[model samples]
Target: MELDGNALGGDLSSVFAADVTGAVFVCAGCQHSGVVASLRVWVPAPGLVGRCPNCTDVVLRLVRTPTRAFLTLTGASRLELPLD
Candidate 1:
């Protein structure tokens, strides 16, 4: 099943200093640009995986443990976060 990026709010907030749902992401694989909230998300995996809506490429991956949170955006060439 695929959930929208909004599902990542709480998890992402754990790692970022500000809300990132409105952040824009540019896919490295196809150069597709979109807001983070527009990505497709999967939750049943080892961690939360967010994919680009345009190219279906992996855009971001986030994993959280009791003491640590891991976030990777290797699939995204650029990320633009909203400033205040």
Candidate 2:
């Protein structure tokens, strides 16, 4: 399923399912995307800290830190609406 920006908040367990090895966070504003390794850390929450691959913009990092499941999207400062 395509994850919309609005559906990003809350617990991210479902987003980082057991079978999901990783995920790519694509920026809606610039189409920048980044790959996140999902097996490295256990993500207690759904947020992270990084920059966009395409735009080099600071992203609101969403991560399952324990499993290393993570993604970086354009922050609310860069967008007009809340990401979730």
Candidate 3:
């Protein structure tokens, strides 16, 4: 199943002070840049994974538990968030 970055809005919001879905992510693997909303997402495993559309690099990962949420942004070289 494929989802978009918006699918992480609810869970990611819990950890981030800003809205993650509107943030722009730069792919570290291929230097591709795009908004999180445009990434190809896969949510079938224990976590949520968002990959780059241009290079298929994993840009976002979210793992949620009853007590904690683990987010990994290793595939992203930069993240630009909305000011307001």
Candidate 4:
């Protein structure tokens, strides 16, 4: 999915393509420029938060959706799916 540029804290977000290769990239907010390993993505329970691998920054906040496939991020595009 295409991330909103305004949602990113800085230019680092620009480097991330919507079609992520599941490879974790370095966090621009921190000095640690090492490659992110073991990248994992999942829908978490209520109150759970997603964090950056390099700097442990809270990147995504989880929320409930009406459908199993609500959003799709692929090939530099963001697609919203209807509830099925």
Every model's TM-score: 0.95, 0.33, 0.91, 0.30
Q: Best TM-score goes to which candidate? A: 1
* lDDT for 21 (candidate 4): 30
- How much does each candidate deviate from the true structure in C-alpha RMSD? 0.8, 10.5, 1.0, 12.8
Q: Residues 46-81, candidate 2: write the lDDT tens digits.
A: 453444445645555665666666654444233322
- Cα lDDT tens digits for candidate 1, 1-84: 999999888899988898899999999999999889999997699989999998789999998999999999999999999887
Alpha-carbon lDDT, every model:
0.92, 0.42, 0.87, 0.32
Q: How displaced is residue 83 in candidate 4, in Å?
A: 27
Runs off by more than 4 Å, candidate 1: none
Error of 3 at 12 (Å): 0.9
Tell me the tens digit of each residue's lDDT in model 3 across 1-84. Answer: 887778878888899898888889999999998888888888688888889989898888889989989989999999999896
Say which prediction, candidate 3 or candidate 4, comes out ahead on TM-score: 3
Give the deviation of candidate 2 from the true structure as CA RMSD. Answer: 10.5
